[model samples]
Target: MPHAIKLYVRYVDAINRRIGRVVMYMIFAMMGILLYSSITKTFFLPSLWTLETAQFFMVGYFILGGAYSLQLGAHVRMDLLYGSWRDSTKAWVDLFTVLFLIFYLCILLYGGYSSTEYAIQYGERSYSSWRPYMAPIKIIMCIGIFLMLLQAIAEFFKDIAKLRGSEL
Candidate 1:
């Protein structure tokens, strides 16, 4: 592998790993928020913000951890034919399939960016009583999508390396 490709893979992996580690704690945050909400509802007036806040945390948790999930090969895959392939054959097939992933991620990222821009420009808010500003979550969505796109590209590179009898 070339130096630049290796460096790119290393940097992207490191970044996604760090971000994923941080995002993992969001589950606890969501749990805490729900616990508080349950307590409040049982003893006092229900809080409008707790449910929505917990949902937002969940969205962040899923989105932000995507790249790390991809890096770890945690995502599910169809394995009927894949299980029989040799490593290089797998890499070849992966290189071909990852193009579709890259294309899909690109489209998703573009849509996410446009949505985020509209949210920011219009100061969009949710319909709920709490009516939290939508831009923050939209921005996070775009960021997560962008990171996933980068990770997909990194995987493409890794596949190429594998085909070349090396690993990134």
Candidate 2:
């Protein structure tokens, strides 16, 4: 059972890591898109969609990369209080904190579903000159949220295993 749990945790970590690496390529794409937008607006004709498309890529970068950040312990925390703790104590604290994380994810998933549904049903689009459909971005946001929630479960499992001294 320990071995199975360990494998599961590693699988979850691997999934996030791989996706995070792939999503990072969007940074280069965003830069190129922004540069093209700037050149067009400055020299030729302004492409209205380019800037907003770049913003969506930025959102994707932050949202899709969230699990990798959490996996690396890169998320900001109160070091003054959390840093002084022992490993075992930290694991315990993390386990408790995950409850709040779970609550937050639940709310996001619930609220996001309705928003996504509305966007799809009404064929929502941006108010810009080059109106892009909102459904795809909302769908991607939901996927990112789900992946983050999965990562939180993986973390909670790791914390539980830590307390048992069979750290994954």
TM-score of each: 0.97, 0.94
The whole-model C-alpha lDDT of candidate 1 against the native structure comes to 0.96
lDDT of 1 by residue, 67-118 (tens): 9999998998889998898999989998998899999999998899999999
* Number of the top lDDT candidate: 1
- Alpha carbon lDDT at 79, candidate 2: 94
lDDT of 2 by residue, 109-135 (tens): 888888999999999998988899999
TM-score between model 1 and native = 0.97
TM-score of 2: 0.94
Model 2 misplaced stretches (Cα beyond 4 Å): 1-4
lDDT on C-alpha atoms for all candidate structures: 0.96, 0.90
Question: What is the lDDT for 109 in model 2?
Answer: 85
